[model samples]
Target: MRIVSRRAEAVVFGGRGDVTVSPVDLPEIGHTDVLMETRVSVVSTGTEGWILTDRFHWGGSMPYPLVPGYQKAGVVLEVGAGVDGLAPGDRVFMTTSKVCEPVHAFSGGHISLSQEIQSEVLKLPAEVSDLEAANLVVAQVGYNAASRPRIHGGEVAAVFGDGMIGQMAAQALRARGARVVLCGRRQPRLELARRYSADVVVNVAQHEARWALSGIAPGGVQVIVDTTPSPDMSLYLDVLQPRDGQVVLSGFYPGGLDVDADALQKREVALLTNSGWTCERLDATLDLVARGLLRTTPLITHRFSYHEAPEAWSMIRDRDEDVLGVAFDWTTP
Candidate 1:
């Protein structure tokens, strides 16, 4: 017998410039599934922002309304009959699920998401709070990009854009003992960079990359992670570490980048385009946060309940700087 509950809720974009919080079907489980009662979920500015504005370019999309969100942390409420290594009371960091249909959930983190997400779901250590784990996707996004070049202890790494991914990337690199530099056009975001252990924060509003980078790394940064949607990686090619510098493009774009292929070949700089993240990366990110090595506390700036999703969406959309991070409080109504 298959039973589906309809008590879940999701924040969906109407595709007609409207956002709403409406009832969705609570996800069910097969014999190998696990059901989670969401405690908290995070709003990824780039991903969620794009969804709200109709600018998101996800490769897979359901013909239904776009239900926005991917990061969620919660407690396991029920375990499938044959599930092992997890109990009903265990706390975990979960991504989206397809439990809620007709909503076209992108990771289904918004509701009572439950499925046999065996490897993708990682048990939260006692030290890490649900609030911090809820933002794991952002950390994984940064990890996915920074891991490409492999910042081994002493390399100078520069993360472009002071947004969530940029800040997260900077912290992730710093955790690896990299001399981290965060470059952005805003001061407030730059200020937030300090809390995550950024070695140097530069305001790139009108600054020259060559000057700023040289001032920080002297011999030029070894790795550069571009977290901005802007595709002008060539503008910062001079900062690449002479012969074998590596660049990781981790940002999302509605279109292609304007680049200079000649510049890449001449510099012998290797560019790696980040293609989201994997389950293993997510586990690694969670472990880092759990150990207090990589701090995400500074990134979370606002909290919103499920009912306040519209307001939360509006704030993240309109007030981009003041609200650097937002965690959806799903523990309540």
Candidate 2:
């Protein structure tokens, strides 16, 4: 018997304000394929929202009618041959690079299993909520950034941005025993950061981040995590310590980053950039989430059904202040 699986997706054409939902057929379960019914998928406000506006990878060519998403958690309804450790009716986290390829083709960069699925499509832990699982992609990126900083106990770390990725990075920094200070423009988001283990929250809109850092640590922050896609790097360069400080750039800066040469030369700081989570890092992140070491439940602020995906995209693109992490709740289908 043959089964027809209908999948709803968001397609992005050229220019901003071009996200639409349409149904696509699910291919037959191959020997290594698993047919999943998506339960929840989170909108990566920093990445997906930018993509919706054609602000990501500008001046470069992107395939038209592209599906824009990377974070998805779902239930397995069918498993293909040669697939082990995953059975039907299992709850799983999966990532698909399907959106990155040509509209009709699937790419090979999908690492959902290694990142959000916890190396295997195992049952969801009792303590982990579905919303939390849905936001695993952000947590994975946060964990990756945290791991790169090699944060040590008693070190001072500063994270720039209060979006999903930034908040998660702050939590991860705290977990590593670093004194974390979150910097952002929004009062509510900064307030939320306080609940996620941020030792200090600074509103950069009203105050200078560098000035604020002076009060937090006279020696300067050891690690600075940049979660905003600001073209000007000067905003963060001056805050690093003279010799041992490191800056990690995890946000999507489409227009390229501008930096003052003297800032790095004088401070002797190391600048690093990361796009997404690697397989190994994703595994560690899921372990942290499963073990309750990382709490992401509070980061999710809004939930929308699959049909409301367009509106959800709009909310994110408009920079809705109340939106922290918006997710697609697919329970209706």
Candidate 3:
């Protein structure tokens, strides 16, 4: 067997309050693997922030010195013997990679070079730009939320949180013919949601969600999607349509999330949750993005070179700027 040693660079979260770019070595590819050189990768400000501060709660115990990212667009450098429908030079979107030791993979997608399983990689469409595909997983999360409930055209849908996932969920709901109402505290994100996806924008900072929702959707909304890390389910319950309402939980709650089961039972609301991406959903999301239905590029408020990851993390943490979608350009050293 021939051996190959690959050196790469990646963003490392060394325990709480630590972020840096460290050198890494890629593992040898297996028969079903594809090695890629990342071109662009989007940051999950919410998830990465929680992990950076050791607040992430899904998995048991926070692992230190880990790579934190789960989505990127890149060029395939090599394809394994058993891999089909993919070739070197193909532009594809990938999630996670088999990063070798010491620095563990927190779903590793920010690395300069990645060796991914064939199933975890997707070939991009002709019209889909790398930037659009770079945030596929997060976009799929939105898609998952919007697709969970059964709704008809012209139904009212309320999306809580104006972050990337929330915005994406709003877009997906709009695509499904729902009149979307976006609720958030960030003015810039709320404005973007109004311009692109939502029919109405509510600043939760200025007005009460229950009051705003009740006024805008007098009969109550049929669909409620919560994408905030710390969600107030009672607020959503107050405006949920009786008997046929559906509530989708799509955020990361560090201390664990709880819902009012009695309230849900009284209204007969269907409580649903979305976690990860699926191949079919990714395919549909990529198509929607390529067809100009999912508005991704417009949401990109900041771009930094891979070397500027520290600055990017700082900006994400500080919130001094009205940052929305942050991407790291890895095309150069």
RMSD (Cα, Å) for all candidates, in order, is: 2.0, 3.8, 1.3
TM-score of each: 0.93, 0.87, 0.97
**Tens digit of per-residue lDDT, candidate 3, span 226-328:** 9988888877777987677998989887767778788888888998999988899999999899889898888989999999999899889997438989999
Candidate 3 segments whose C-alpha is farther than 4 A from its true place: none
Query: Which parts of model 1 are misplaced by more than 4 Å?
Result: 60-62, 112-116
Model 3 alpha-carbon miss at residue 211, Å: 2.0
lDDT of each: 0.78, 0.69, 0.90
lDDT tens readout by residue for model 1, 137-168: 88888877777886668999888888888888
Model 1 Cα shift for residue 61 (angstroms): 6.3
Model 2 TM-score relative to the real fold = 0.87
1 or 2, greater by lDDT: 1
Order of models, best TM-score first: 3, 1, 2
The Cα error of candidate 1 at residue 51, in Å, is 1.8
Model 2 residue 238 lDDT score: 61
lDDT of 2 by residue, 1-333 (tens): 755433445433334577556544444445666656677777777666665565666435544556566666767776766777878777776766232233532111112221222333445566676677777778988877777776659999998888878888888888889989999898888888888748899998999877889888887778999888773467565667778678898887766778777778787778877766566666677788878778887778888776776777777767777888777776764
Candidate 3 lDDT at 301 equals 90
